[model samples]
Target: MSLFKNVLYFQAGFGFLANTILLFFYTFIMLGHRPKPTDLISCQLTFIHIMMFLTGGDICLTDIFETLNLENDFKCKTIFYISRVMRGLSICTTCLLGVVQAVTISPSTSLLAKFKHRLKVYMTYAFFCIWSFNLFYSSNQIFYVGGFTNVSETNQMKVTKSCSLFPKNYIIKGLILTVSVSRDVFLVGVMLTTSMYMVIILFRHQRQCKHLHSTSHLRASPEKRATQTILLLVVCFVAIYWVDFIISSSSVLLWMYDPVVLTVQKFVMYAYPTITPLIQISSDNRIIIMLENMHSKCHKILLNMFLPFL
Candidate 1:
């Protein structure tokens, strides 16, 4: 295999293995513990993580197969479609998560306050809407093959393949770009504005508490802690994602498809999900305790259930 192909395999395989471990630990061990109903935010995060795992796995397998000079077939097409959709969904879900966090942290008197209580209630419906939107938006991708190709009369290599909607269908491309750009912009804006607001609020609250000699208020402010942690996460996410977006967008605009860009894009998409566990671990102590408790309970239950058979 060529060096580029070898790199692709290495990256994809590493991503796949990492995501698999994450999925197992988070979904089975962490998420399954205690069997309590999940909140909106938790459920959304879980869904995104699962999708990320699957997409990573697909990318790894597809790249491996392509490196082996395998021919594209029906299964390849299916994988292509699913991978594209999952990637798009991952972006959408991450943005949704940021939005949810922003809403959660918004002041009670804010316009979003009315929707606060309904977030949990409407979370399922909101996910359904997002899923539906992505399903249709990516439906045209079902006809694609995913692999490297050399552009005519150029040394530039691109990942090009068939799709239901070709470039001739500018309307569809326009709609897709519009939806994608609008969603990304909104999420980025919310993340930045909310984070800034939270910082200012924290500063003001600290100043007022110090003035009043109320150290307890400063220490016990859930809003301040949640806001700060989420702000950090959003910052990390945006930092990685903005670079990926710029590179990918540039590739598309300049029509200079290159293997390096493809590899980087894969890394960024997979990294988001793989590192989420660390974020959760740092942000939410309660969740860690809950997961541990659930694990213990499950172990006891499993021992009791299997002891007789043993």
Candidate 2:
């Protein structure tokens, strides 16, 4: 209806579409071709984004849970918990992606190179651990979030049109906040570290290329392009994540959720997931080539279908 609402709808629709395409691309790669080391993580992240759109009502244009006709409290708990888990997974997978890329680009003599043979094994283990941890960590949402009641303003913070968070004692809130902050900070730190490492590696490689040849000879390799994509994603994720962290933390601590602030926070929070697939799609030459092939095939089919009449 409103401009803001239209933007929200467009954002959700575009993001959902992009993520689905990316997911299918990775799925096809894994099934028919040799998968890259980072393919699994990319696939998982795309899945997470899709779930985020489905369960996170603020980001999704529709209230998907409403169609289920579940009890209000159950619906609230289910949505919040699943959304929290997906949010956690997004960061975890992004961090893993960067770290994997860093390892991928590391020089053969470097220490990280030693793990190259076993990187896939380690990534499988990492996925299991990340999912398990996020599932357990976000369980608190089940207890804290529920349908709004006639509770006093001081005792409840409205989270959505239908859901609100029950007030907890300062100690409980403090503990939850501490753990959340710790996890985010640690993951963000890892992203930054890996990003810096990749930058150094790229710089050195570029320097070496320049020394050996003219400037025009310095084309970005597959590894370099992948690294750059990951770095850009990390920067985008971190910037948006902190903006959301600040907004959410302030709302929780102050026991207030301003309508405008919440709206802005939703936009900020979904921005990363929305843009991630676009970044991947644009940077990935394989996907581009595949798309081009598909387009040409369709064009040939159309010409064949119409040429007899002409």
Candidate 3:
């Protein structure tokens, strides 16, 4: 494979592994194998990311086997359709995760604080609603996109390097346009608002406690670390999301297929999926606990075997 292809595969592979690790951690929490409040929204978010990476793999494989789908419209539509839905679901889940975390740390007097009592239940319902909405909304992709060989006026048939959506009627086209734009705007807006609110809250709390310590710098508390992680996620997300949005919007508005634009967009979309889990694992004490337990168990096993030999 070429360097470009190698990068895409590696990015998708690493993201897939990260999501798997996160899923394993969340699954343990949900199954009660681990002692933690079941964070339903976070579980949903990780699941969605896992699905996104899987669908991306499917797309990548499709690119490799282009000969099979070179003249097949159905094969093209199926891949793109799955991709659009997963992409939409991923964005919605990310926004929901941000909003849930924001509310979790909201001040007791704040409106979001009212949710503190039933946070898990509320988040469960919220995730269900998000999944339902994304499924129905993105279903339009079936009619909006497909594989086709378009013959230009000069009489040459052209197969697009990347699948492109071409809605049949103005109404379908308008709906797709509106939904795509509005979805991104709403999700990005929510993420920005919630993450900033959280960062500010953590900052204020840190400031209040500053005087209690000496002039030496201190390690971040769990809350502060969580806040910083969220902020980093938001920053990475917004930077990549807008760049992907611009390239996608340009592709849609201009109806031009640029290989460079498509590749860059793919890379940008992978950014959050690759980074978020690393931050989660690094900041979470659960991983440390698991590691410590494993170390002790292994030490005991080794001692038993060696002692018996001695």
Order the candidate numbers by lDDT, best to worst.
Answer: 2, 3, 1
Candidate 1 lDDT trough over 10 residues, lowest sum: 160-169
| Tens digit per residue, CA lDDT, model 3, 153-240 | 3222222454445635677668778877887888899898898788788877778777766433245376566667667777787887
**lDDT winner between candidates 1 and 2:** 2
Between candidates 1 and 2, the one scoring higher on TM-score is 2
Go through the candidates in order and give the C-alpha RMSD of each one to the true structure: 5.9, 2.1, 4.2
Task: Write one digit per residue (lDDT tens) for candidate 2, span 1-310.
Answer: 2677668768877898999999999999999999899888899999999998887685543366677767989988888898999999999999999999999889999999999999999998999999999999999768988889854754778877888988888899889988999999999999999999999998898888866755444455776888899999999999999999999999988889977777778778779989999999999999999899999999999999999999
Best by TM-score: 2
Better of 2 and 3 by lDDT: 2
| Candidate 3: segments with Cα more than 4 A from true spot | 33-38, 57-74, 150-164, 167-171, 211-220, 295-310
The sequence of per-residue lDDT tens digits that candidate 1 reaches over residues 216-284 is 775657556666666676787788888878887786666555556666676676666656656655666
Report the lDDT of model 1 for residue 165. 17
- The superposed Cα distance between candidate 3 and the true structure at residue 77, in angstroms, equals 3.3
Compare the candidates by lDDT and give the number of the best one: 2
Model 3 whole-model lDDT (C-alpha atoms)? 0.71
Clashes of 3: 0
- What's the number of clashes in each of the models? 0, 0, 0
Colliding pairs, model 3 = none
